[model samples]
Target: MSTESLGHNSVDARSNGLFGVYVHWPFCAAKCPYCDFNSHVHRGAFDEAHYVEAYAQELAHFAKHTQGRVVQSVFFGGGTPSLMDPRSVGGILDAIAKHWIVDPKAEITLEANPTSVEADRFRGYRAAGVNRVSLGVQSLREGPLAELGRKHTVDEAIAAVRLAQSIFPRTSFDLIYARPRQTLDEWQDELTEALWIAQGHLSLYQLTIEMGTRYYDLFRAGKLKMPDEDLSADFYEMTQEMTQKAGLPAYEISNHARPGQESRHNLIYWRYGEYVGVGPGAHGRLLINNQRHATATEKLPFEWEKRVHARGHGMVTDDVLTWEEEGDELLVMGLRLREGIDPARFAKLSGRKISDRQINELKAIGFVETLPNGFIRVTDKGWPVLDAVVADLAA
Candidate 1:
């Protein structure tokens, strides 16, 4: 469908509501020891043009199912989306605009590494319609940078951030705290520097050893030193206090942003909005035939490409969620936001109300509280045990 014809339809597929498109680029220059994401390092050259074509076909395939939706955001996430040629990025975007009525003010973001080479393309990405950039600057310390398998130096990371801020309308960078033997004082100093460099957004994540990563193997072998439970709690509290004081408060548990600078693409996921995922290994939540369905694509890159060419899409799973499953997912995602969940919405999704006895018991222990407007949220005291709180409420 042409953009003009698509625009003429006033029915929004879900207009007045949140909808998004996520494009996953699964190639990375190198894999980090701590990451378990679906990323690969190709030893030889591959056809970038062919892959871009697959992405376009997949977008068209989804467009047929979600016709007339006004896309509120488009995110180019990856193993490393910055590695993509600017023309490829532009091609994928053109395909998106071809199939749907992309909102004029839609937030378009790309995730990039902080290498100088990638930073040089910031202007090109901007020219191609990407208005936001999120850099993977895991650390500012030289020692930790090496330990984390990051190729960029601290100086290079800072330079990239500065360059991105100058080029993009919005920018954000990530930092991983709670590293081995990281003192509270050192983190305070480092984060202070980061806030000074930050223009509007920061994603501060605590280090955790997930299975299938090198860090997990090291931890199992007792070769890795992790902070004890108490120290980790101290780190979390310090992070909350410092970012809140910097006016970039934690809108979600791991993401902090200046008012109105929050990542709109990510908000779609956390707020339980529908989105279509394109590309290998991407997962999506979509509203189909008035039912919420969970969809996933093949994880292997070449296999996914072959499937896309064979059947016009690479989707391997599309399960319709039960009402109870919908309620559970809403809690799993919505509770991550400081704004919390609506009891009425939960009842509507689940066909049953959350147990009042559970809420009262948790509140008695200072784990949760009802807002002045009747929204229920986990208190700071409860954030450390958020999973338990959600489980109790959902049960």
Candidate 2:
């Protein structure tokens, strides 16, 4: 497979079928205050060898149900997958290859932090067959980094990114904006610097206080203040303007990439393609017996390992979705892309069409627009209130 057109455009809603595999590494060096992800910080040495064996077992189990499917992408996401030994990553990738026909040009990515310690393993990971690495560089400023409880300094993050660029075929980093007390000018400066150093892809996310996170408690206690909606909107607009000017445009709500440089793993999800999610707290969507099924596993790392050992797979939920539910989910995921949702596909899935009343009303207000290909996308005016738009259309 050629690499030239892999990231050229968003996945076609009606075609470009994709299959992916996601492996979650549930261990973090230190838990961030604002993260609600199922990542645990282990004080004592854990059984890395045991976990690797369990992962292989789980992959074999999934392969049984998904035989003959070709995997186009594999993503190692987590509490911090970089914490795992590079050899362990290699073993898992090997297991995947043993079961499924992994595309030779498949996008294999590993999520990492930018601490110097973790960056030291970049070459090892490259040798392990990970062609892409996404760094968790939440901020470029010391103040925000400290506030976010990140261990790496801005200097370290930049160095790690440069190093990854040197080692991997592709590299991307993340940034959090709309943070407490962050000014527009400050973000613009930071983002400008980020773009200058960025290779092709970036993920700029607006901070949200999720339930059960320490940030949520602080927010409720009046100790932390998020950017006001108006200010946050301004930040969002500024981000779009700056990234577009830099040649990377918003391909998804929070993800920006040059044409064809988008993350293929995430595209699998947004395109509503089939993928198996293995690891604790991982979620999967698979098509079996002519129906799409949603799958989730136990959240506890050790518990999931035990279940995988005992039951061959650690799935806790395997609910077959109804056509209506598939339609709603398709709309929800598809509309997130700049490419938008294919109305004909939605109708085919739901056995009905999206309300013309809803589409016309939104179009009249400049909140949604139809593509020449008959796809529908949220406009800049609608992105800020995307949930409402999706609900109105789905309803």
RMSD of each: 3.4, 5.6
Q: Candidates' TM-scores?
A: 0.96, 0.96
lDDT (0 to 1) per candidate: 0.91, 0.91
Position 223, candidate 2: lDDT: 100
Collision pairs in model 1:
none
Candidate 2 TM-score to native: 0.96
**Tens digit of per-residue lDDT, candidate 1, span 263-329:** 9999999888889999999998877556676889999999999999998899998887899998998
- Who wins the lDDT comparison? 1
Predicted candidate 2 versus true structure: per-residue lDDT over 1-395, tens digit per residue = 01231222323333336799999999998889889999998889878988889899989877877777889999999999999899999999999999989999999999999999999999999999999999999999999999999999999999999999999988899999999999999999999999999998999999999999999999999999999989999999999999999999999999999988999999999988889999999999877655677889999999999999998878888787898999999988999999999898898777899999999999999889999999999998899899999999999
